[model samples]
Target: MRLKERTIAIVLGGGKGTRLYPLTMDRAKPAVPFAGKYRLVDIPISNCINSGIRQIYILTQFNSASLHNHISNTYIFDTFSNGFVEILAAEQTNQTDTWYQGTADAVRKNLKHFHDQNADYYIILSGDQLYRMDLKDMLDRHIACGAELTIATKPISREQATGLGIIGCDSEGIITKFYEKPANDLDISEYKVADSLLHASLGKHVDASNEYLASMGIYIFNAKTMEEVLNNDKTDFGKEIIPDVIKQRKVATYLFDGFWEDIGTIKAFYETNLDLASINPQFNFYNEMMPIYTHRRHLPATKVNFCNISSSLTSEGSIITNAYIVNSIIGVRTIIESGASLDGVYCMGASFYETEVEKTANAKKGIPNIGIGRGTIIRKAIIDQNARIGDGCRIGIDDIPRQEGDFAMYSIHDGIIVINKNAVIKNGTVM
Candidate 1:
């Protein structure tokens, strides 16, 4: 299929990210620093650029300064004269009087820019996901099928399908039935039946019951379809818009059987990062054939000492001393204290636990001292940027339930906890 004329994409980066808790408490969801080196926004933006789609716009809302700054500094390149990235912050015009309410509304609020550019296709993606997809292929399929809207679909586990936007399609890959979250098991089963109409394996169709698919929240909208839907909607793209459009429009489904993960929650975010550190990760970001682009901060290669480290992606200037890091990621300019222990953890850029904390209270809730006497041990945790850990603190290792104190404690879906920046703890505190 021939490429559509002048395609433009808008990445939604405005979510508050409350599920990420303390880490996102200060920044927007997309601006949240992730996996030691890059922000959450980097993944989607990188995906867009790598997929050969430029002229991208990132929509931002809460704490957009850091997100905007990172995008401007990192994503600016001189390769293409016509390629550029822009941020569309939530603002009120003389007509409307509030911040963006939802994803559809955000796009609707900025309809003028999209219309002015006269883009034929509008690709919409969330910034809080960790998946690498060649949107060009999806766009090709969309054009070939003459679809008003094309959605990226991925097969998901039956038990886990309840949380996502479940979809159903016809034999020609035209979506027919769509549900945000179906309640009854029989209805979900029926939805799966409807999905089977389009997703048959050509030579194999009997085992189609196991072939359940859900929307990835990635959409390619034919300009006219987008103009009509957003112009007539008040709810979100999935919850309100797409469900109604599929009934009246020629909506198609693009099947993708690769690794696609939504890292919207703390547990999912943490687990996906650890997945990158696996010996044979399900999601291979290091694939030389399809590497995920970043801001390209130039620094020296990481130095590994007698530390037992493996399967982890270490950015530049990360000094791993006589510590044990397994299946974890270390970000740029990070200094791992000597004799520290880490496993299945994600340490953001330049984080160092302070060596000073008054042991006035029982070794609990607050930051734990991180020296030899403090005895720090971390397991399945995420330490945000520039955090200083004291001498002796145990995180996720010992079976100590988190307690409330001066420092905050957040539990993600994968049980990976988050430590805020510059949080001070006394000696021998248990997390």
Candidate 2:
């Protein structure tokens, strides 16, 4: 059978992305707006489609309304084609009555749907990571090695290995042992990879530190092996299943040297979004051969009058007048009035334009417009969708507000202010 037809992808949409708070308040983490317009889920979905793997399933739970909306609105396949991108939510059954306990349990509970399909292999991916990869290349390695399961690994520093699944490998690039977040003094030098293995898997060595091989949380399973593994009561792949399998099965590693970010925390998400606006971005989204695919908004082009924008991205249907924006990302339907200044911010913009009647009613209610107001100064902040920042407000201008906690209206993390979705900043407010 052809390789393309023998595989299907399963994207694990995480449960309650609490790490990305306020952003995940109204929508699932995967549905949270990313890179100004695209959702976090689009990264893996676009990779799968571009890699010629069309048949897919997205397993999601916890506030999936916006996620379901985005998926349904986008990704329409041919009428007669077998290709599909389906969303699978956890449900109660005669045997089980609870939600998914972990990533492996999520797949184990849904294995019934996949059981009927005759695919040879299953590709597992995370929905909230940023990377561009062709799964076909990893699949070829799995098939060639005759591996029952293959994990994609990347070289990481000693400090980074404390929170990830670190793999121990042999000279032939076969998995030998697995460690989940080992302590600093545990001595993981036994797993130090050979130069030949690094050169063969990735074109070059990515880390000069070369302390450990961190799993990218990407997995490819031989269909039969997954059936055998999931038959047991193991709850999570990283903490339980993978460690057990490496000791018994034919497992290999596929190294990826490219840019990959796990946008799991508010700090990570905020920093990663701003990474796109850099002169030489760590992760480039402008690859002509494989651009990131997203739901087309069909909104009109961005409009600007006497605005000064540099090193920023403004999405469609935005109206900017007499605003100075630098090193920021303005999302769809955003409106920036005159005398406003934004620097090093990520504005998700409004969900929808407020009608004239709605505006009049809002005025009566004393609510501000769904965008930046006149004479406001915003710096190093994240303005969530449909946020109302009133006139003459000062956000992160003089006070960094460096914090690791959340307030009722917003959060200040790593010296950057994050305005929650649908939140209101009163007129003349100073934050």
Candidate 3:
């Protein structure tokens, strides 16, 4: 049972990832790079493709140029196939003259696009999330139970439920209550899902410690239900739309016991990246069945002359000479000079290399070429794409430095020490 022809996935690239700070400084959150080889948007998009849901629409309003470029360059379907990865950028027209105000508003404005496709059901996805799910299975359950709306939910601890879209369902997997990030003291006794329902929903995959279900922000709606529900003035989903329809509609929850993380904030993003470097990573990049796709750089294998890299991922076209990198992700086209030490860092390598003439000009201006400098020590930091690290410089807790102010042209995020894209650093600098 495939929903390929009847389902069209809509991936919402949420407005400028304000929580992600420097990473979102110049690009949309979904466009932000992840796991050394792919962008955050690739997760949901890849999931859609792997599930045979190839007709994807990405909606973005903030810094969408980069996102557009990535999508355009990467996804190209054959002439006979109707499959495509298109971007519906927010626009102003005679009907309206404003940007997308919220999630519901964004889709409300673009309803015409989906209406033309006439898909029976629409799957809504978050572009900046990390997970792999088969929509066919979830849709199978949704259709079997005749649910008007279905939410993909994961079991979470009581403490973790306080900051998410908390769900409460009955014994038959039918939702009875929806709480959008309830306060710690909020009473939720009557809304809690029955233990039998949860155990039956997951069966052998049940976790005894998971007492609450948290929404993954992935919603599947019947086409008519979408039209009737979104034809309102509501601006958001978690805040307005879901709450308004739960009682009047047949809502249900689909249990997902996979590794899912919302990479919305800087801390969450940093932690998630570092987790990829763990020995037994929760989210493995080497999944052959459902591999995450990305724009191919077509570069050669990385060259390490005398560097020591352990539990780290180094992408293509990187050159590390006599350096030590531990538990980090070195992005594509990175060049780490001799004697540098990096620990728990995510270095988003340069997008392109500088020509010899460009390097000479950069040297004249006393700026380091796009990579870590000789003898530089960095730990627990994120180096954005095309960043330069000067020689003999120390970053991230080397001198017990908590200063977050810009060092040269770099920006800091909650002491994570981020060097923004295409920024430069001077020699012997410490932060």
Candidate 4:
């Protein structure tokens, strides 16, 4: 059978994104908006589609309404193609009534749904990540090595290894050991990559700082091997299944040299979004060969009138007038009134446009409309969907040191102010 026909991809929709709070307050981690228009889940799904692997299933649990809607509207396969992008949500059954305990458990519960796929290999992916990779290469390596399990690993420095699962591999690329998040005092020098392995992967001598191999949480398993490993009650792959299988099975590692960032925390998400507006970003979403796909709103073109914007990405259906925006992402349906200024901000625009009557009514009630008001100045902040920033407001631009915690209508995380969805910031407010 062909590679596309014999492989199935299962994307794990992450648990309640507590770290990405307010953003995840109303949606699943995978459903959270990304870049200017795409969702976090779109990255992996688009990678699958671009790589000719359309037999995809997303496993979701928490706040999956928006996720389900997005998948249904975005990824639709024709009957002739026999390709599909399906969702396998957590449900109650005779076997169990509890939610997904962990990553492994989520797949284990849905094994019955995948029994009819007849795929030779199952590729597991994380939904909340940013990277573009041809998964075919990893599967090819797995077949060439005759390995039951192949893990995608990234070379990282010692400083980056503290919070990630580190793997130890021999010269032949066989994983010898696995350590999950070793502490500062722990001696994991033995797990460092050998010079021979580093040269084989990168084709050059890399600095000793990038010695450790951190698991990218991307895995491909032989169909039978996946069943065998999930027979137990192991809840997590990185913590339990992977470490146990390395000893009993042939587990290999595939080195990924491309840029990959785990959008786990709010700070990481913020920085990653802002980086996309740079002159040259590490992760390019503009690749024609493997373009990232998302919901097609078919909205009108953005209307920028007398705006001094620099190095920013503005999506469709936006109207900016006499504003100064720099190094920011203006999302769909955004409206920036005259005299507004934004710097290093990600404004997730309104979901639905308000009519003139509605805006007038809101104004009479002393409420800001669903957009950035005139004379507002926001810096280093995330304006969520449908947020109403009143006139003359100053957010994140003040020199006052704000503690990292949730406040009324907004929160401070890593020095970035995040205005909640549909939050109403009164006029002349300063933060």
Q: Write the per-residue lDDT of candidate 2 for residues 1-431, one digit (tens) a residue.
A: 67877898999999888888878888888899999889999999999989999889999888999989999989888976577888999899999999989999999998899876689999999988999998999999999999999999988888888888899898888999998898988888877888778877677545678657899999999999998998888889989999999999999999887888999888898889988987788998889899888898889999999999998989899999999999999999999999999999999988799999988899899999889999999998999999999999999887444566789889876666899999999889988
* Candidates by lDDT, descending order: 4, 2, 3, 1
Against the true structure, what is every candidate's RMSD? 4.5, 1.5, 1.5, 1.3
Error of 1 at 91 (Å): 0.8
Candidate 1: regions farther than 4 A off: 1-5, 193-209, 351-375, 403-415
Pairs in steric clash, model 3 = none
Give the per-residue lDDT digits (tens) of candidate 1, residues 56-169.
888888888877778888877687446778899988789988888999999999988777667889999898888888888888889898999999987665776878888887
Per-residue lDDT of model 3, residues 1-431, tens digit only: 34687899999999877888778888988999999979999999999989999889999988888999999999888877688998999998999998889998988999988887879999999988899999888999899999999999998877787899888887888887898887888876565656787777777657667888899999999999988998878889888999888989999899998899998988889999999998999997889999999998899999999889899999999999999999999999999999999999999998898899998998998878889999999988899999888899888746674755555567676768888888887789887
For model 2 the local lDDT of residue 130 reads: 98
Which pairs in model 2 have colliding backbones?
none
Query: What is the alpha-carbon lDDT for the whole of candidate 4?
Result: 0.93
Clashing pairs in 4: none
Q: What does candidate 4's lDDT look like per residue over 197-224, in tens digits?
A: 8888778657778989999999999999
Q: After superposition, how far is residue 149 of candidate 2 from its true place, in Å?
A: 0.2
Q: Over 4 Å off in model 3, which ranges? A: 404-408
